[model samples]
Target chain A: MSAQISFRNLTLGYERHPAVHHLSGEVKQGALLAICGANGAGKSTLLKGIGGALKPLGGSIDRHGLDPREIAYLPQGAEIDRSFPIHVYDMVSMGLWRRAGLFGGIGRADRTKIEHAIAAVGLEGFETRPIGTLSGGQMQRTLFARLLLQDARVILLDEPFTALDAKTVSDLVDLVRRWHGEKRTVIAVLHDFDLVRATFPETLLLARTPVAWGPTAEALGPENLLKARRLGESWRDDALPCSDAA
Target chain B: MSLFDTFFAPFAEFEFMRRALAGVFALSLGAGPVGAFLMLRRMSLTGDAMAHAILPGAAIGFLFAGLNLYAMTAGGLAAGLLVAVGAGVVARATGMKEDASLAAFYLISLALGVLIVSLRGSNVDLLHVLFGTVLGIDDATLMLIAGITTVTLLTLAVVWRPLVLECVDPTFLASVSRSGGVSHIAFLSLVVLNLVGGFHALGTLLSVGLMMLPAATARFFVRDLTALVTTSTLIAFGSGVAGLLVSYHLGTPSGPSIILVAGLAYAGAVILGPIGGLAGRFVPRRHLEA
Candidate 1:
């Protein structure tokens, strides 16, 4: 597969301390990859960097030709205001923003597409309901519907299955598989090793630095897992700045 | 016959009353939706701060031009925009939150404005700037209010989709479109423009009252933003007419009367509105059969 995204010595962080430190890797087109890491493992940070939400503090992320907006990114614990007075249909339709744009009314075709997307996510009857009234899982489903409408070549899911019920998780996972079947690059930050092993062909283990990268089985080897655990991501504020970070 | 005279006569018998009614009507039309948007953004306090931020600019205009409508409008617009844009800039550059920066700017603005107004003008002039004369509104001021209202409503319509998207799911909007920040800045500019328009009749202190009170009142009654904006505008409009009549009869201050009417509606909505008002909270409802 040709490289869709290539990171060259990328360093991403808040303030000056690097959370995703000295990473060099490539996400090939159609690669189904899992990013496994501890709580502060810079998994979300890396996703943000690639999703264009966060600018790289150092190095470069070469996306070849993909526009950052074209990459559908789902951040964990979505930054949406739940109390915002928007209906599910309206919220889901916003996924077509890349195409419809500002002042571009959702045409009949777009409405049909939105309805299909909503039904796909099992939110058919709840289209008119306000998003504020939705439960956590239902809200997640709504967002997934939006993601489905995004129609991007690359999809990044940060802790996609967090706090979801078993049924919901399985359904969302099937959707992810559907995206994979379409030959789209799917990168997910996952905690469930079982799910990763079963679904993902490739894995990148991070611990403020790369622990291992390659085939899921090898990358998540017991020794590498132990090394990742030992390389705790806590910041030592007084520690001298690393010269190689540049 | 007397009842008709009480309400209709005041509006018909005198031109000033007619102008005041027209001024407040235009204000209600524009300020209502603008205020509703402000409330939705959870920037109600930001609206208040911006109102004060415009005071000094308007005051400076008063100092130089002596109550010239155009000069004060321009000054107030400049000042309000400066604070709004300045607060946003400071928050972005220095990592300080926008609210903190806004509060800082507005305090300075409010104090400086009062000082400037008091420097040359008498206590009555100071009072006039602080609490405007809705009844004394002239043709030029009426035109200013109407013009600002027209601009505000048109702009609101043009930016409605992006503006709503910007408020609801800003993160998603940012990922999908570049209109997030543009809509935000546009919304802020509208807020300042409405305040500048309102201050001419309601004064800086009470101007935001028209913008915020009706919006706040409408929240209890509606769940959808469209409904909220419409309801708020109607409430503002109702308050404008009612307050003018009350002022016409009671000899009370018109600006305060208008705001007080809005405040009353807000309080009543909080207690009685069906959505989430205290009464609804206490009153038991039949459970939804799943």
Candidate 2:
């Protein structure tokens, strides 16, 4: 019952231009895959394409039997709306939006899940607080609470640790490890190389195209990293391989 | 007299008064929910533009059909929707902000409406187009209001969740739903319908104010969507009554008077609202926390 995602010749971006051109890749069921790239290198765009936010500019993407709703994506922490007054409990409950009947009302079981998700993210006491009051780290934790409530088999995190302190980052890493161990596919757009090596078993490096994708140890090795850095401009070609460079 | 007798006295006196009251309620019902979404989407001005853009449509309908209320109303709705969609497309195509485009559309429509009316054979109908003063409220107008409210409400009920999702977090909604794009289109269409229907009582110039101010006032007292919608409806209806009574006593136009009443409510909310930007300075943080 493992979840799998496949991208075939997928080119993603705006209607006028393509960002990730003709890139193909896959995440095996239950793999913690880190997507790392420089700014504007199509890391976020590729994640959005996989999560079905951006329709591919060319080719196709198939998520074998897995519903898009069953995929949870935590956009960059700062991108969330904090102004309108809403409590953490209700925010967490939104994960059940699709699961709630067409009329969209949450039931008792859904409430229990919301509470459990809040507890999972160590936000037990903060359930009723307005989401706007939360610190940057706390907001990220609340987002995690929401994702956990979704019970999605696939978790896509876009730089979830950007504004957090070092301690919070480690704690988040532990949570990702726990999720990975439980057979959930975790693909995150991460900037921190150390965190990626420590937590993720696989890595997908991109700079407008797939530069390297493989087991974490091989992909993050010194030789492969150098190749990835050098291939920054011409990464769209896809003719070169990290293994060959090594 | 009992409080009810005083407050509800106008309902008993004249048929026109009753129709006017009914018209207010119908307009509020559609405007309340539609306005809430507009505020959520930060497109309050879009409602403003739609309100104004309907002018030419109403004027044209009046010119061609000559006081045929239904035809005029239909013309206004068609023109309003056309301008709304056109503005959206122009914004998308040219990298222009929607509000900026809407402002241009409103000006063009308003001018065209005035120009068309000027060239027409009758100069008498111009009064209804601008002020919407009480000339003679007809059963047909009531029916029109009721029909418009029903359609707007039914469509809103179906698309409530998606529209809300789209407003609160479009990126998240896009990730979860298979048809996010479709839901967005439907949401905008409902807004257009609601604005077109409500355009009669408030006029295109002030319709957005009526829709927006009540909701803005309600936001001071309520946090959840259900409470917010209900409170806004009450505020709108109450303001409508106040405006109607003021106009009845002073012999002023109903539309402007009603808008002034709602504007006062907005001022009160802005001063006394829990998280009122200015009022926040005086109130303690714990008191304002939702």
Q: Could you estimate the TM-score for every candidate?
A: 0.96, 0.87
Measured by TM-score, the strongest candidate is: 1
C-alpha lDDT of residue B105 in model 1: 82
Cα lDDT tens digits for candidate 2, A1-246 = 344988888777764355786677677898889988777778888878778777776777889988776789888765566765567887777788668734867778778888988887778899878777888888888888878777788999999889789887877788888898898898999888988887877898887767789988888777777766775643334443333111
lDDT of 1 by residue, B1-290 (tens): 48889779998888999999899999999999999988888899998889779888987887788878888899899999988887777886788977998899888877887776677665425466679889889988998899999999998887888888778777677777777666777788899998998988988889999989998898898888789999999999999999999888999999999999999998999999888899988989898986
Which regions of candidate 1 are displaced past 4 Å? B1-3, B114-124
What are the lDDT scores of the predictions, listed in order? 0.89, 0.76
Candidate 2 collision pairs? B51-B204
Q: Interface RMSD of every candidate?
A: 1.3, 2.0
The alpha-carbon lDDT assigned to residue A213 of candidate 2 equals 90
Best by DockQ: 1
